[model samples]
Target: MVFQCQRDSWARQFATRVVSCRAAELRPEGGGEPVRGFQPDDRGLIGDVPVLRVTRRGPEAVHFVQAALEPGAEVLLSLDWERRFDHMQQHSGQHLITAIAEQMFGFKTTSWELGRQRSVIELDTPSMTAEQVEALERSVNEKIRERVPVMVRELAADDPEIETVRSRGLPDDHAGPVRVVDIEGIDSNMCCGTHVSNLSDLQVIKLLGTEKGKKNKINLVFLAGNRVLKSVEQSHSTEKALTSLLKNGPGEHVEAVKRLQSSVKLLQKNNLNLLRDIAVLIARDFKSKPVQSQLFVLHRKEGDSEFMNIIANEIGTETRRALVILEQDPSLCPQETLLFLTVGDEKEAGLFLLAGPVEAVENLGPRVAELLGGKGAGKRGRFQGKATKMSRRGEVQALLQEFVSHGSPEA
Candidate 1:
């Protein structure tokens, strides 16, 4: 059936009589079970109610109204002009690009999507070159400038002229005659989507480039009419922002950003070296103490796994007599805190190594981790993982001290 939307794409308002009204079960917001007869309003006249959507149900054009209505009520349907116009521009633009691409490069369009922001057409080619894209855009816009007429023809399903037009076949539930959209001197295809009456209505088309698709296909992206202008405005705004931040012209933005990234990398390498040196010194200071404590705890505002490992290596076999816990500042990461706990006297230590009394180290390591709202695992004497409540660090410290003095964290 040729609906009003397809017959006259330019129509903004439609007046129709409701043949039937029934409660429908619609999917609820955020998606769960469908809600039956979810009426947001009471029964009303045509002008008081609004049509939410109009779709084809079998051979009938169904209107999903926002309010309850009798079987024979008349309603005035108002089209969202802006949205409808956008669809028209993009749908017609797709036809132009699809036709020109096949004509120039023999890249037939397999399918296309009229996306909310932009439109994409999948061509039956493995790839598309920049030169081909440029040529396609030029040819499409040229036809638009020439103001080519777009006509629609409805013929019987067995019409002889149907063989001359491009078609992907009709749907199983399709009824009535076949509708073909013809672009004069360009191409003709069987379609049911709304389209502009003239190529000029597309205003202009900008080929945004291509991306790889399934089965060795290429999807070409594009924008038409007001979308092109909007895209240009957004791109210019971004360029201006980049120019201001980089203190360079738009042409130099790439080089400026590359140099900045190189400088950041160098600074990070130097910072890591300095952190390693600091870790060594901290380990040496604890080892050199006249009377060594049983527990050694150190917290740094900024350090990663590498920094913690350096300190553990410097401690060496000292872990046999002391339990060391290294932690990043809890306040720095209020959500989750990183921790490294090692209790071993081995010369070469792995992460979270435990070399103390089998029972003491095993019990203390995991228990302390639990106190900080986290979980950890260790074989000899090492425990490491993230904690959600590092604010309970004091309790974990006390537990460690008790374990060192009494041979058990619980005691």
Candidate 2:
């Protein structure tokens, strides 16, 4: 059975008598457990009460209401005209594009979607060239300009004329006559969606371009009617914002951004070289000490992993009794601190370069990490990981001191 929406797409206000009213659970389109009394704010009104949603149950139009009503109550059902018109424009535009593509280029449309902001039609082709898209858009708008009539014909289920029109197939529960929408001298297809009466009602169509689809198909995206105008306005606003920020015209925005990127890359390269030099100096100062402490700790607010590794490699070559811990200051990263730990000793620094006591490192590394609210792993006397609580660095330092004094983490 054809619903009122399908029969008359232009109808904004519908007057009808309620057949029945009952309380029931309704599941949202985005599948979930059934909800009771789901009142959506954007729904239309049934007389004084809001219509939560409307769905098709078998051949009947089921209206989900927020409140109970008498079985024979007379109600005025009003449609959100703006939204309905948008849907009509997109739906009709899809039909036009599908017909033209199939007629002109043999690119048959497999399916289509009338999206909230824009619409898409899936063509059974591996890819679509920019030239083809341009041609299709031109032909579609030409038809709209000509103001071609869109006619709807209801045919008997067993009618021989049904075989002449394009159709996917009838639903398993579908009954009664078949509805075919025809674009004059263009194409005819079986459809149940609401659409405009004339091609001119589509206003204009803007082909946004194409996207790769599954199973060797191309999804062509487009904006119809008011959507095309809105898209142009949005693009112009974005261009103006970019022009102000880049201090360049819209045509030069891309070039200006490229130049800025190049400058940033050069500055980053210079910064890394300076950081390396600083790492070398820091290591040299520690090694120059006549009598070095058994443990060396350093924290730098701006140091990265590369800088930390450089310092570790430099100081690691000569110190046999020292254990070094480097921390990337956690102030900038309130939730986590990057830590690097290395034990250096000339005796153990052989082919594998085993830096210090393996037992001491294995025992202290994990314990230190735990106290700082994190986990770590290491081998050959080197450990590193991220810690959540850098404020407990003092506790980690104390643990390191104990390990150094007793030559074992347990002490």
Candidate 3:
């Protein structure tokens, strides 16, 4: 977990020699055009002291490299050790992983990134197999264990060694020395990010997974050093929870879950058959007893709507019996309930309305639905609707009772 940081700069008070200049005095470097109102690289404070660090060379007039310091002004310069170390470990691990993939499987690393928690390398290949990932994990960790030296050198653009290195490309305004990193005998590539001095400093490299990326490429997700340990801890906790819930060992949880799902399905089927039978019995008893005008059953609970519909259908076929089934609103609204109405008279032969008059039942669904604060639709004397206001159930029931008794819903 050793960290090596090269890019981080600390603001220290440097000797200042102020000089006046004009716009025309600016000189662009590497033959680039001059820009106006430029900014310096770094800024910090120490008591009454203000310091600026020059990070890059630019036009002489617009960019000032130094700031005047009052006599006896104290200065402070510090580095974020944890941040520096994390960046080094991830960046160095990336170069090693990229090199191993390219050398072993011919899967070229098109690009890579050093994220906050994890890093990813985009490969030129469209997809990767489980076996390929395993192979990569094995080869990369092997190099980490070997602890190869990482050498950085600034090479001239025309140098012979430059031709042997793998590089993304130089910047468009290139004019300086090309800095290249060499992972001993494994890889040598041009990079600007900070990195560890040796493969052993990375501790380990773990390839978590891969996903299909844009333009038919593959992205390899990975974690290095302490991050790998954190992921392992979190995954272990989740497995323990799943094992306890399933009442089985981690290896047998999948089969245990499958068995539970199958049992649930069987129970649901049996419950539905029993409800249908109960509906038949209720309808038959009502036919024999012949209650006043209509046989309306209201249950205030979840799962009663299906039973209501079945019972209504059974009651619809009996002589002189019209059905109005309502279930209480699960949402706790008294005026809003579910209604299932079917006015069928199968015993009436050709008329089909003698058992429960069709004219009386035809328009009842719409009015009942309106009282229930919703709309409904039906044909051939069967309909279902929602009542937005379950409190209005009395009005709906009264209307249905009138229709069943006097052969007119309005009556």
Candidate 4:
């Protein structure tokens, strides 16, 4: 049987054959026990291949290969070399950093995770100093400059070399030889994940910063190789945009933003004082009119419902008259129209009295709501609702005017 390996700039594809086929279970990370009622199909292969997809079980499971093949059927596999290479760079850089940190300062690493844009290693310490991070970065880069060879060795579990290597405990199911990755004169670790073949293959590792983690662990965030380049490009683009928008040098962007914010606050304060004066004028004009009917209808084009409510309340307190306020619609359905109602009345005692009783306010609320295709509620003689059908504003006003002509709730 012939095996074909196809190479490209982004990925590598290959063809292999299935050795065996069976069912398998997938295990969850950090789940101490296996999950029940979950199983997936698997196929066995004679050659090595990288995994890209996963089948999850309920909560915990085991990993298995998935392929559609008989004993000797050909299988095509596609591997993303760009992603793999980036992972290798990051994983290799992490090994060097972890080893150097432990050897020089005796700081033990508890755990580590390789993220999409960055990676983090949790140090088993309460905190890390700035000087320690700088020194660790310097040492890791020194190893990269030396172009140290990375060697892989597989030895039996009882071999003498097994006793000398560093490991984070073997799984209970491990039955075969243990694979050890040795970085020349730097570190040796037992890892299942992939890595670069040489120290210089990492390119470089830049320590971004650190943060406090669970159980007093210090998480060191860093970027490796291509991720570092991408981060720098993004930051440069953002700085250029900020400089252009602020019309200032990169260094002065923060000061310019602060000045703009201060100017905005001053203008906002002035506009609020102007709105209060306008409310007073609107109230005086309504009170000057001699219409003493039980209901007053008015429509406004400017200001929101809240602003209009302020002017309506001012009219109520100044003239102590019942009022209905709404937005005048210049268009038809789908434009928002606001409706508000308020009445002047004294609080009546005894349990039989109606709450917030206003003849037009109570009777007109639901009718106007139907015309507006919405609902309204009120307390202390005031009601408000919003309508999407702007064309019904005239119908709402005509109903209120009809109720006002009869002069009572009974009418």
lDDT of 3 by residue, 235-300 (tens): 899889988898889899789889999999998888778866876786566556623234354533
Candidate 1 local lDDT, 165-228, one digit each (tens): 9999988899998999999989899988889999999999999999998798999999999899
lDDT for model 2, please: 0.75
- Each prediction's whole-model lDDT (CA): 0.74, 0.75, 0.62, 0.63
lDDT of 4 by residue, 115-217 (tens): 9889999888888899999998988888888999987677777888777888898776555567788898888888655677788888888998789888878
Which stretch of 10 consecutive residues in model 1 shows the poorest summed lDDT?
330-339
Cα-based TM-score, every candidate: 0.77, 0.75, 0.52, 0.61
How many clashing residue pairs are found in candidate 1? 6
True lDDT of residue 311, candidate 3: 59
What TM-score does model 4 achieve against the real structure? 0.61
Q: Give the TM-score of candidate 3.
A: 0.52
**Residue pairs of candidate 2 with colliding backbone atoms:** 320-345
Clashing pairs in 4: 25-62, 26-61, 26-62, 27-61, 27-62
Residue ranges of candidate 3 with Cα displaced over 4 Å: 1-80, 156-163, 173-177, 263-411
Model 1 TM-score relative to the real fold: 0.77
User: Which sections of candidate 4 miss by over 4 Å?
Assistant: 1-13, 19-52, 55-71, 267-411
